[model samples]
Target: MSIKALITHIQELVSAQSGLAGLNLGLVNYGVPTKLPAIYIDGLTFLDDKLNSHTFNLCYVTTDLSIEQLDYAKLILAALQGSPCVQAQQLLPRPEPENKRNRWIIPCVFFPRALKA
Candidate 1:
């Protein structure tokens, strides 16, 4: 399948969650949302194992960084991990700048050969 299809699948899964009902999701190189709990594709790479690694950023844009931001990111991570369509890899926490926003970089791999094009 194409990257767009993967993005669509992830959007659908995240949308299905009541807690993330208002979360804004977007594609990378397009336009990322300025709102909190916003998720967007960050990068994509082809693996030698016939899999594609898709990197996504789940971010909370806030002037006041708190534990709530981390918690929300965790929730998103859970939803992403629960997806049966792709193999969720890892959720890497970004180092906070103390004055910058909080974000989690998640990398998920999917076998393109197994998915219908």
Candidate 2:
């Protein structure tokens, strides 16, 4: 599947959760929301794996609540890790300088190669 499909899936999941119902996941170029608990795809790239597929990382930006952010990250991880096309992932505590937006990164590699058409 494509990166947009994965992002759409995560967006759906985040929307379903009442606690995270308003979270928005978008490409990094999309205007950042003036809200908390948002996610953005950092970028996409081809992977060097045997599958020769694609890899990307999603940045989960939230408020400074460590526990709440952890919960949100866990929810995101669970949603992403459950995808069959997702081969692997590593979620790390990623901090940033923009408005104290606590961040977590979920770097993922997926199959169904993104070779040149």
Candidate 3:
């Protein structure tokens, strides 16, 4: 899938979420957001020369400091974390923000798809 398609897929995945259904989600140019619980797909990239692979980050922003956000973050992680298709990294809390912040970021990789050589 293309990058745009990947973004759309991510959006769709989150959009279908029952809890996060109406949350503010979109791409980011790296700026201060004006909303809470802002989930953004950013840092466009692919992990392979074939350009069939994709990797990006999800930043979950909210003032609600707790593990509750993890429920939302795992939605993406679980789907891609399966087997052979995609690889998902751990969703960790930001190092700063007093070790208890409002944002958690997960770096996920849609590993390179094997194509006939």
Candidate 4:
């Protein structure tokens, strides 16, 4: 799906809230390879009332997949890199699984354009 569509969907899933929080959801038939079966996301960062800095805490969720872990990671990283608003992107430590399954969580932060000095 297009980035615009994805963003819209995310906004809907998370709903309108006042605070810093993340939202995690799945992405199916995303036109990507099998390695990347799900799309984990955190809450979106937006300018707060103060207009001094962005407000929103990071959140994450995982989805089941039928592909190599490394490949999935690569796809997510690539997608984030392509985005214009994302910055200081990085992956967090892998979480331990309760059962035998393949999962990956890609964490990233979005920083809006700063005012010109």
Q: Superposing all C-alpha atoms, what RMSD in Å does each candidate have to the true structure?
A: 3.6, 4.6, 4.8, 11.1
Instruction: Say which candidate scores most in TM-score.
Output: 1
Clash count (model 3, backbone only): 0
CA lDDT, candidate 1, residue 39: 73
Better of 3 and 4 by lDDT: 3
Query: Can you write out model 3's per-residue Cα lDDT over 22-73, one digit (the tens) per residue?
Result: 5455543233466666766656574454766766676667676766666766
- The alpha-carbon lDDT assigned to residue 93 of candidate 3 equals 63
Candidate 3's C-alpha runs over 4 A off are 22-34, 79-86, 95-101, 111-117
Q: Write the per-residue lDDT of candidate 2 for residues 1-117, one digit (tens) a residue.
A: 555666655566556666555445443322355566567766677655555677777778877755666877877777767665664466798777565668888887766543222
TM-score, prediction 3? 0.61
- Worst 10-residue lDDT window for candidate 3 reads 108-117
Candidate 4, residues 3-114: lDDT per residue as tens digits? 3444443343333332212322333222232432344444434544354334322223244433445544544555555555443366553543564344454554443443
Question: What's the ranking of the predictions by TM-score, best on top?
Answer: 1, 2, 3, 4
Clash statistics: count for each candidate:
0, 0, 0, 5
Could you give candidate 1's per-residue lDDT for residues 1-117 as a string of tens digits?
476776676677677667765444443222456554467665555543433444434333333367666666666677777776566666677756774766677666655554545
Question: Residue 33 deviation, candidate 1, in Å?
Answer: 5.1
Question: TM-scores across all candidates?
Answer: 0.68, 0.66, 0.61, 0.43
